[model samples]
Target: MARFTIGYRTVKTALGAAVSIFLAQLLQLDFFVSAGIITILCISITKRDSLKISGERIVACLIGLLYATLIFELLGYHAVSIAILFLLFIPSAVSVGAKKGIVTSAVLILHVYTVGEASAALWINELALLGIGIGVALIMNLYMPNAERDLLWDQVKVEDCFRTIWKEYAKYLKEGDSSWDGKEITTASTLLSDGKSKALRNIDNHYLRYDDYFYHYFAMREKQFDVLESILPFISTFGDTVIQGEKMAEFMEELSEAVSPGNTAGYFLIRLDELREEIKEMPLPQTREEFEVRSGLFYILHELEEYLTIKKMFKPDPKRTHNVSGKRLTRDLNKKGSKK
Candidate 1:
């Protein structure tokens, strides 16, 4: 029973459908009508995908039913007609419905069951199953919205769209981590996309109102996207130079870690604020090529390290900062606070 419950989305769906089915007959509608409603409720969208899948399926099923009905009327309800219908009707309807297998199934079932005005029992059963399938799918989606899971791989692919630039950054930096290689960037993109999508999709479920939760979730994702965009070109140039002189790149990475934004060490932030002042005094590179191509990466790192340093000042490290740095530092960490 446990395995069976895990194997299919049946347990919850069955319970839902049974309750709906009972409600259907109780409402004086036929068993099929109740089942159909149940199915629709089950397969409804819980994520941000819109009714794209459900709409597609409904359309394909209707087309298949219509096509089957026409063929049966014109050619008679013979075995050959069913077979012919399978060939022409299935493919034709499926093409319109984007050729999704489930869509095709809905269409085929509707088509065959409604042929020649079948017994009411057959119609009821067919409608019930269709409704159950759709309803169950939707219910499952809404409760735990798989927007995160569904878009993960695709998001990874989209992030790779910026990979050429990042590779250049890594090359310029001359010191790359194979683990944090081009692939991990791709993976991070995917995770962010999935997370964002899931966050958006949780709007309609009958469970917790994740609308607020998702809002913050996607907002973070959007910030990550912006950060990656800003750093891409710089990383490319930095990586390329780092590769040219490995030791300097290593030193730079170490320097970065020493003052990284996540750390409690004040050295990175202080050095960066000082370096930003130095960049102001330095002469400009002669050309765009010189600016991007010939310039050393330490300068860029210094600028970034400086910016991160400033950003870090407000970020409190709770573990080490067990004792407060007075009210000033606490208020400073609050970016929105109106502190002079």
Candidate 2:
């Protein structure tokens, strides 16, 4: 058997359902159990989603009430009348983007049929149940646990992974080959994907305001990761180290140490330019093998420049107080808080 644990959403669902049912029963509404079901359905992963679905349910339920009264009264509450109502109602619900509330509205329409009348009192009672259920769900969703701390930690982990990957690349350049399993590449890819998803969920939680800081951060990392991936093939082609490889190895090691969300890319770009010129000024290769190695090193250098340029263009939000190594990250790490 799979182990089951109660998470925040689970607890909120249980509590919201109980509160909805209690409020409905207290108000003496018919079919009060349905209110609990509505609450369970309305509970969503994000506050905005909850509110959007709740609005859809309320609107669809009211539309269902109107259809149920008109059709059931006109057609004498027959089974065929319910079927006809659905044929017309399903299209109408879908057209208004209330398709998510179809089943919820169907339940209320059945309640109207069960009551066997279109009285104003019956409509008010059903509306009361709807309000109580959706209202309780909205209240329950108001206290989403803060995810910013976890997002910051993910950012740190991604940078650490980048540092490790660069160090591995440097090792490959310094020596012909290393025994690295290349797991950091896989790990960084997974972290970037997961981080982007969580950041998007965070965006959804803040409906009234815009917050895309973490989302853009992860996206920037993903672009840099693409550059890193492109460099891997170049590293694999080198079977022997040349004199240029040693210089490139040192540059890669330095880049590894500089893998925070900092703008130290400008300094690195200048250093890379000087390194290119130095390599150019060196004596010509004596053999084809040495020439190929030199060429691959230059290719790697070009890719590294692109990688750094990506970071240089990124502008992290200044107001965010996310920390790296227990120190607060400044608005411009290269110009302000960076060691460079």
Candidate 3:
């Protein structure tokens, strides 16, 4: 039953089409069925997209009306004239970036050809029908209730994928195992890419320009994912799980747990600084192999620091402030320390 349930968009499209048909009939417009068809074509998943498409459709209809009127007046609505009309009309529409309107424009041109004349009254009827259809679709799509919720869900899914990848990296570091499947790396990359795309679509669904925080947030995460991929090869080159490796593994485990919206990466940055100082105090690498491994670890650490810095520096929108209170987060950590 859940799987079979229809979405709000389907219901809205049906209702809008019905309204357009009824309005066209009431107005006694010629080719009244076009109103219903146009409504169906214009109704999209998002309000902004619906409006954009409807505007394009209207412009395309006007182009078709102009072309059909000129051709019918000159060639007298014959079959060959209709063919010539299409050859000229299609190119003009495509040249003006109204290629999406090709089908709807064809319908409008055919309405004139079928009537055997290019009368002004018929043009008025077609324009009225277009208005009824596009207006109804715009009205129906004015509200989208689930866009923000869906964006949030995508954000969480992307963060979860990132957590999994970092946890896998921790496992590889602690074990120094070459047998890691590396599947989560690919999975995380795909998830981030998809998440960013969905977030952009969600942004376009809204009317306001200010509701783009999720899009920016996903973009930042995408940059961090690139850094994570760079760190993977460094982690894979370890010969043994030394003390420094174990410390980094522990840090990664902590980081994986902390990967969520609204959480600051300040604590992680501080811990990284401490770890860097600790590494400096350790004895220098004794062999060429040891130096190479040590240098790789340092490079990985530097990249991780950059990744955390990107998150730490991000300023979320004030109106859409989903961030947890820094003081409250610090207090919660303190309480955990006390309990320990």
Candidate 4:
């Protein structure tokens, strides 16, 4: 059974709806319940989306009032007239990029239709309702819980998965036909996807000063993941372990240990270059099988170098150093727990 818990969005919606309805009632507005409904509709997952939708809805509501006033006064406010009005208004709203506002506008239009008049006082009441609903929802959306902590947790999971994946690569090279199920690769893909989504949400939360640092970080890691996927076939083709395979496996172990958000890629790149030169000096393969295995090792090394090169070109925000440190510490703790 799924656990029943009231999320923050639910709390905000309930509180915002209550406040809107109460305020509308205190002012003696007709159809005060509509204000609460509007508030509920306006509440969104991101502050930016809420603000954007609220603006669209407000503009569309005003446009709806205009259309209703002209149409109702001319067409006698019949049901067919309402259909004609929607046919015209829907197209107009869509053309103006107010498609998301159609529902809210329809609600306000129904209020005018029920009143059977397009009087100035009725429009004022509707405007007041719109203001109350949108205002309260905007205020509620302003208190979005900080997502940084959750994003940090996602970052840790993604990094840990990457480390495990690289470790598995090293294991495969060192001991061909091992029992590793390649689960870490799938887990890393999922974790990277989820982390990137959370990072984008974090970016959306900030309106003016957009912090896309985490988003870029995840994107870089995703590119590196593609390289890792490409290396899998090469790892699978090795039927017999050669001397070069063992050396590359040692390099993979070093790479796996250095899988972090830090700028240690340059150091590794130097080490990788030295390894490449050393491999070039090694004796020629005596058998076709050995030659194929050595060639696969070189391909794997090339891909690994690309992986490090990607990290080398990418730079993280200096201000986030402490946060990365905290994630690393948490990851280390989790690793210890898993070992137990």
- Give the best candidate by lDDT: 2
What TM-scores do the predictions have?
Answer: 0.43, 0.91, 0.84, 0.93
Q: Point out where model 4 deviates above 4 Å.
A: 322-328, 331-340
- Give the alpha carbon lDDT tens digit for every residue of 213-306 in model 3: 7778888888898898899878877867454577788889988878766546899999999988887787899988778877887898899899
lDDT of 1 by residue, 1-340 (tens): 3453342334545565665566555645433454544354434445333245656565665565666667776887777776776688667756685454344455445445445554455445455555555555565555443443333333333333333333434444574443444554565566566656555555544343443444343444345445555655555544333443343344344443332113443665555566555644556667675566335444455445544444444543343232322233334444433551
> Model 1 has how many clashing residue pairs?
30
Model 1 residue 248 distance off true place after TM-score fit, in angstroms: 15
Query: Which regions of candidate 2 are displaced past 4 Å?
Result: 319-340
lDDT (Cα, tens digit) per residue for candidate 2, span 6-55: 89999999999999999899988899999999999999999999999999
With candidate 2 superimposed using the best TM-score fit, by how many Å does residue 120's alpha carbon deviate from the native?
A: 0.7
Sorting all predicted structures by lDDT, with the top scorer first, yields 2, 4, 3, 1
Q: Write the per-residue lDDT of candidate 4 for residues 1-340, one digit (tens) a residue.
A: 9999999999999999999999999999999999999999999999899999998898888888899999988997789889989999998888888888899999999988999999999999999999999999999999888777677666677777787877787887777746888887888798789879988888878778898888888899999999999998888777566445788878888777777677889899899999998888888889888788778878877998899989999887776544334355796657865896
Prediction 1 global C-alpha lDDT? 0.48
Model 3: weakest 10-residue lDDT segment is: 321-330
Task: Using TM-score, give the best candidate's number.
Answer: 4
**CA RMSD for every model?**
11.3, 4.8, 5.9, 3.4
Candidate 1 local lDDT, residue 149: 34
Q: List the residue pairs that clash in candidate 2.
A: none
